[model samples]
Target: MPPVTERTSSLELPCQDGCVNVSIVVPIFNEEGNVGEFVECVFAALTPTSRAFELIVVDDGSRDASGEMLLRLAAERPWLRPVRLVRNYGQSSALQAGFDRVRGRYVVTLDGDMQNDPFDIPAMLDRLDSDAGIDVISGWREHRQDKALSRRLPSYIANALISRVTGVQLNDYGCALKAYRREVIDRIRLYGELHRFIPSLARDVGARIAEMPVRHHARTHGVSKYGIDRTFRVVLDLMLIVFFMRYRQRPLHAFGGLGLWLAALGVAILSWLGLLKLLGEHIAGRPLLTVGVLLLVVGVQLVVAGLVGELLSRIYHEGRGGAQYHVRDTRN
Candidate 1:
């Protein structure tokens, strides 16, 4: 888990009178060159809509002048709200901090690097509003502008693998431009690098998700924050998502099932050795006895772990007052 420190606002802000129609959250880290243009682009895209909206830019402890720029921008633009964390807590944490302060019926998230076009916001909002069933509208960069080998190729493979594992079937999990209904997003708790798996996490809670192709631009400032190492991180996070999806409620089923199979195999092996001993064959010096004993011990330990997991699961829900199921709505 990333250290979540106390957040301070660069400007003393007043709360909005009512819930705005839309809230846009962009996580910023060392993007001094793009911050000004990014704000301008967002305002250009949204100002004509005539719908109430707020722009939240979270500065994740940038070593550059990004924080200073945001402070100046927020002071000038009343709608622009800036959040500054004590230190760099990565993108996921910054987004969560922004999400916590959103006062909108609909939420939009995009990267601050300018690769994600803010012009796509209106179309996504339209799609989400016009359709009654869709709860999430994810942007897909079909014509990605990054290098094919170093950037796009690994992302392509990762998106496919994540889709297959989580059963969400999204074409671009890495794309940050996505629109979500407030109710659906409120149910989610962001931590770790799970922001990329938002669509999948929303699906787990019965959200109706859709994807559309959006514009992707080449980076013109600073440098790329990600590298080849990101692929490995994605793989590790994917495994955690799979575990929570399948066995979060009843982890005993996953561990105990494997334990039982190993214990049965161990029993079979030891029983064969006993039969050989009955036939007057030397069995004490055989390696099969040691293998059988090791299997039995490991199998028992796994079963104990399963029991412990069950206890933790109960405590987690009961302590947090969380229910195993979600209620979409209720009526008389």
Candidate 2:
């Protein structure tokens, strides 16, 4: 294998001629120990399916031998295409880079770690291909192999919260072994930690989603890159998903609702204080009066902020020629 910088900078692999059936995208981040075994398993599993497939391995600025290994693998195998990002921009960004470059009818995503089985890819692809109505098939790690307290518990809580908030219930939001139709996958863009909410975002765009049980294996490689610290980021992304799902087109409605409630409360407080003063009570220097005034000011500020949000949302859509609604089919 060549040096990481030289290989990554010069390597460029293109999809083979003819239509591609499936593009398997795996985002690797410092998974040098597992690269060889992972690729071997993936090839062994997909080869039997006899599908015109391409393997897109995104080397997310691994500070190890991972990039070099991928370059060597790509050099020998025409199916393996290595995409090296300039630096580590997290898993979501790496996945986005792969997704942007895929040229297949079906796009599948799985983790680089050996924990997620590559064999699940075939069944997921089959499910999507069998039903035109099913645009996305998510993997459910029914019997997760991770620690119950540290990973499984928080995942369960977060999955439940996401199901309720997005109304697109799935057993596992953290599973990376998922399959999606090319059109469905291309309809949405990813940012931050939004990759976990792909199904939810797809649902927002009228995608039909389903879940199936997939095999999971315990890690036997380099240290796990993820931890409980990601929970905070997941929660924040979930909130963004909820907002985008419901109020992405009408930003004013979400902000205005809270603004109205706060303004109403503030007005009620001030009215009560004014009535007390009119009834011969000395309300000067009262804490309630100060709080009421503060609330009124904050309420007005919130309303102004809501207006600004509406303007920004308008600019976001119109400036970029984006549409809030997508049409499924039309006949004259």
Candidate 3:
């Protein structure tokens, strides 16, 4: 066959119709047994598409044969891009690596375990096709196949809390399958659990978001990884995301909001006490007075905290980096 022409831009290929460009990003942790079938299924799903596409598989230091399988597939298929991490970095890092490597105008991310249906890829693409302005098409799993306690319950609670906090009403946040427009992919910064918040982050940066119900299949290989501990982690991340989304741009706003509430209540209490004293009211040991003083002091402290947060943010942008979650271990 002809020598494969290589493209260098971030979006190396755009679809012929200029409709919806596509990239299939698969993050493989340790699913050694499923690699072959997964690739075959992905290619099969894309076989009839008229649009241009590429498959990027990130090997997160898989201790099993996943790395070798990806390497072998990469040699056979020009569209197959294989990335290897230095160690077991986890799924978020793997997905980010794929995102960094994808050159298609629209990037679609799916798990390597073969749980998320590649057949649904075109559904998301179709949604994007109908409306080009949409920045991301999130896959909503209406029929989840994982265990009720392990996956469904935790996911429901987390998704609900995240939606309420981020103000992005996508029904599913933890669904590993989603499609991102090239511009949307370019603008958002990816980190730790922020991958789950991509839709919200994109919206924060003025990108349109949409969601669709996608086909969810039961896992074909390996054991499920969800647990109660991870559930707590999800909640914790949600709270942090709430703070980041609401106050990241204006640290003063977040801290100051609380401060203002406290200060107002404190002032009201003191004002009432002062009016009582002026009227010859012997209200010396009123609990409101003590509470008011305490609230005032705390309010001042909160304002100071905002100032510190602002300075820290400035310093972060100046040279030093911002907060990063360091991974101590992963199961790949």
Which candidate number has the best TM-score? 1
Please report the candidate that would top lDDT against the real structure. Answer: 1
Q: Please write out the lDDT profile of model 1 over residues 154-269, one tens digit for every residue.
A: 79889999988888998999999999998888888889998888898899888999999999999999788887788999999999999988999998898988888888888999
Which clashing pairs does model 2 show?
A: none
* Model 3: colliding residue pairs: none
Clashes of 2: 0
Error of 1 at 238 (Å): 1.1
lDDT of 2 by residue, 115-182 (tens): 89987888888888789889999999988889647787778778988888888889999999999988
CA RMSD (A), model 2: 5.0
Model 2 lDDT on a 0 to 1 scale: 0.84
Give candidates' CA RMSD values in order: 5.8, 5.0, 9.0
Tell me the whole-model lDDT of each prediction, alpha carbons only: 0.87, 0.84, 0.77
Regions of model 3 farther than 4 Å from truth: 1-20, 260-297, 312-332
lDDT (C-alpha) at residue 235 in model 2: 84
Write down the TM-score for model 1.
0.92
The count of residue-pair clashes in candidate 3 stands at 0
